[model samples]
Target: MRIVILCGGESSERDVSLASGGAVARALLERGHEVVLVDPAAETPVLAGPLHFGDVVDEFAVGKEPPSGLGRRLLQERMEGALTAGPVLGLLRDADLVFLALHGGWGEDGRLQERLREEGIRFTGADSTACTAAWHKGRGQAALGAAGLPVAERAQWQPGIEGVPQAVRLLLAAGPVVTKPVADGSSVSVHRVDSLAELERVAAETGSGGVELLVEPYLPGREFTVAVVGDRALPVVEIELSSPLFDYTAKYQTEGVSEVCPARIPADFASRLQELALRAHEALGFGAHAYSRTDFRCDAAGEPMCLEVNALPGLTATSLLPLAASGAGWTYGELIERIVDLAMS
Candidate 1:
């Protein structure tokens, strides 16, 4: 399979995208695929860098990393051309398949997928509309609830003259609220605000970003993320954080977190979690090409309260997908190969 992975995006998750691309590229190659890993930072005659679905740029600069001088310069040049603008659909004209590892913005939110569909490009995951639905945390949650899945209570911050009142209503409905940007991933801007004063302070400080916020009831339980690939739930990856709550630092750079697979939770409860994850994926209209990770909080009684699903889970070597793959008896390379096979078939 001649696969080109679209990596690096205009989202805050740009760095994470690069890491995932690196792992995906390596795995593809190890399994003997002719893989060309292209970061938006490395596209020539094409716009590469960060494209907030084409608005913002996260800047995946190639020459910025530690590498040989020639390699650095060549990469820098290729990365420079990726941003040229006709469309990703146009740029991908020559490829057999695109393994999308991008997070946030147009890429994850189904914008790129929509464009690709217009060009008849074969890719992974759900259709453009489905991705868009999955990407919006608030909307997706509502959809899941309507599908009759068990979920935690949460509220969204819709902007307008009634912004404050709406927020207050959301809080009043579910609290102490866990607030963060609605469209953001990896828990950016996420904080557990126990007091009204703290919530007001955060809203004031973080408001300039302009993205709407979501406030959900802070559930008390063990944090577990159920990984769903294809139609089946792979395995439960239990997230153990050094901090009381899992924050950004705990997600990436810091070794402050660990994941336990098969979760040590009861078999019946584990099955339920997997069922909910799959149901959420299906209700979102995801197909065989689509993969998502559904997170949950299991109370002491082991009843799972569904958190939102990450339709675009991280693809990096250490990400939950690969971690779950490891636990499910698929080696990193094997899992990557399987995904590529699925992406086109």
Candidate 2:
């Protein structure tokens, strides 16, 4: 198959997306599939590092350049262009399939998917409608919770300029709440606020301008993520962070953090999580999501608290999904193959 791997975007997650593209490119080639890596605008990409997840690829990352050499350069050149899909959807005209690794904003939040739909292109993962539903943290929470799934107590702000006041009030109500760009992955702009003062500060700091905020009751539980490929959950992973929380730094900082697969938690918790993950994916009308990572916080009673899901989950070598896939006995190449198959099928 001729595969076009798209990454790098105008969003804050550009670096993370490129790293995912690198791993995807190598994995596709190893599986004997022809590969072309392109950025969100569909331009050729170049990075000077090991290209793994969380290596401080640039200033945006921590403060280090990933180990570099032949591997980095080779991955950089495997693609025809490194531009984002925003401008390069034209370039994908003749490709067999588009495998999107772009995370956050327009890339993952359904903008690009809508464009692909208009162009009548074949791509991996869910469509624009499903993409939008899954990315909107508050909406996903509502849908799942209504379906009898366990979700943290939460509220959503309305859309439009008038939405600002409603947003602040909601934030205040969900106090000791965690604020984030509701549609983003990798937890960008994610933070905990304990007082109205801090909550107001964060409300002003939010990107996407008056975009709805997902304010959920701060629950106490272990954060575990379930990575689902197609309709199946790969495995469960428990996140252990050395920091106060698994913010962007811990997510991409790769220094001392570790992930325990088939998490140490009891089997019942894992089963419930996997069940809810599939239910959430289905609820979104995600006909063919190639990769899905459902993040949750399990309370002291082992009750799984549903968080948002990542439809086009990261592909960096050390991402949660890859870690779970490894435990499932699927090599990097195998994982890529499974994703591409679902995406193009």
Candidate 3:
């Protein structure tokens, strides 16, 4: 199969996406498939750099890492722009499938998926409607709640909306609250606030960025995530982080964090987590073989509260999806092959 693995879009997760695309392209090549890795943000998308899939892995293995502090800010500034898709669409014309190794922002927010559908291109991951429904946290949570799935109470902030601060304060009055952009992934800009002053500061900081925000009472408990592919859940993975929050660094950098695959919990609890994950997937309108990672927080009563679902979960060497896949007895190469097979079928 001739595959164009799309990655490195203008999102905060661009570095992680590039890593995932490199790994996927290498794995598919090992499987004897022709792979073209493209980054939509590149000025010359077809020739951004040498496709050196394995070489990229070697570089990371040698400690070429994600940018930090000022460097991180500069890279993020460059990635905040929209994607230019002309060159990528041209590459897709000769491809059997465009494996979506991209994450967060527009890549997972349905715009790219909509464009692909318009061009009649087949791609891995969810359809545009499913992607849109899942990317917007408010809509996804409502759909899950309507389906009788347990969802944490959340309030959304819209531009030009009055009383935004008051609403957030009310939410925080219940307890510590988690505030994040409504449509971002990788836990970008996710903040936990325990006081009215903290809520005020977080709201001001988040609002200054001009994206809609969602505030929910922080569910205090163990954090676990389940990866779903084709209506079934892979093993659950518990995320333990020394940081106050599992932000982007903990996810890709894998520092100050530990993950337990096939989480050491009761069998019944694990089963329930899987069931809820699948239920949330369907309730959010994802179709068959829609690869996603659903996060949860087990409350005092042991009930799993749905955090949010990543319709396009990270597939990086350190990503939770691949970790869960390994626990299910699927090698990384096999997982990539399965995703492609499902999309092509």
Candidate 4:
């Protein structure tokens, strides 16, 4: 099968996406599939020749901050122009499957998926509608809540909106609040605020940049994630954060976090987590053979509450989906192969 892996977009997760794309390309190549890696945001989109794992590993040596200002503007311009470029579209149309290794921005937010669908190209994971619903944290939480899934109490705030601070103050009255971009991945710009002053500072700083934010009561229990591939939920993986929040550095840098696969919890609890994960996936309209990863955190009562569903979960070395897959007795190559098979089916 000929597969074109899309990675490294104009989003904050560009480096992480490159790492995922490289790792995926290598796995698919080892499985005897024709793999081509394309960074849609690049000046020359197609990444020719075989991928070297060493080079790929270096791509994600990301700093604590995301790309900004001039660099980001240039990349956005290139991404907008490159997607419709003849070479890029030709590769997409020619491939048997276009595996999305992208994480945030337009790539994972449904815009790119919609374009591909309009061009009559097949891609892995959920369709544009599902992606759109899942990409927005508030929207996804609403859908999950409507489906009777437990979700943390949350309030939404856009930049420059009046009375948002008051609402956030009300939410924070419950306890320390977690704030993050309403639509983002890799935990970019995520922060935990325990004081009104700090919350004000965070809101002011974040809002000044025109980013929408969601504030929710901070869950004080264990953190876990479940990945659903096709119709099956893989084993649960527990996250142990070295910091108060699972920010960008903690996610990509190995030392800041530890993940325990098949999380060492009671069998019933794990089963419940898996069930909720699958239910959340379905509630978001993900069809058969679609894949997603649902994140959770236990509340003060130790009951699990849904955080958000990753429409296109990362496949990087430290990514939870592959770790959960490993716990389910699937090798890295086998996991990639399974995803390809599901997409082609």
Clashes of each: 24, 19, 0, 0
* Model 2 lDDT, full chain set: 0.70
Q: What lDDT does the true structure give each of the candidates?
A: 0.70, 0.70, 0.78, 0.87
Task: Report the lDDT of model 1 for residue 283.
Answer: 90
TM for every model, in the order presented, reads 0.84, 0.82, 0.89, 0.95
lDDT by residue (184-282, candidate 2, tens digit) is 677776777787777666777663455566776665667888888887876789998775466776787688477899788778867877888888778
Compared with the true structure, what per-residue lDDT tens digits does model 1 show for residues 97-149?
88788776656787778777877778776678788887888888899989998
At residue 159, candidate 3 shows an lDDT of 43
TM-score computed on alpha carbons, candidate 1: 0.84
By lDDT, is 1 or 2 better? 1
Task: Estimate the TM-score for candidate 4.
Answer: 0.95
Residue 57 in model 2: lDDT: 28
For model 4, residues 211-316, the per-residue Cα lDDT tens digits are 8899999888889999999999999999998888778888878899999998999999999999999999999988887899999999878999999999988898
Candidate 4 ranges beyond 4 A from true positions: 50-60
Residue 249 lDDT, candidate 4, scale 0-100: 87
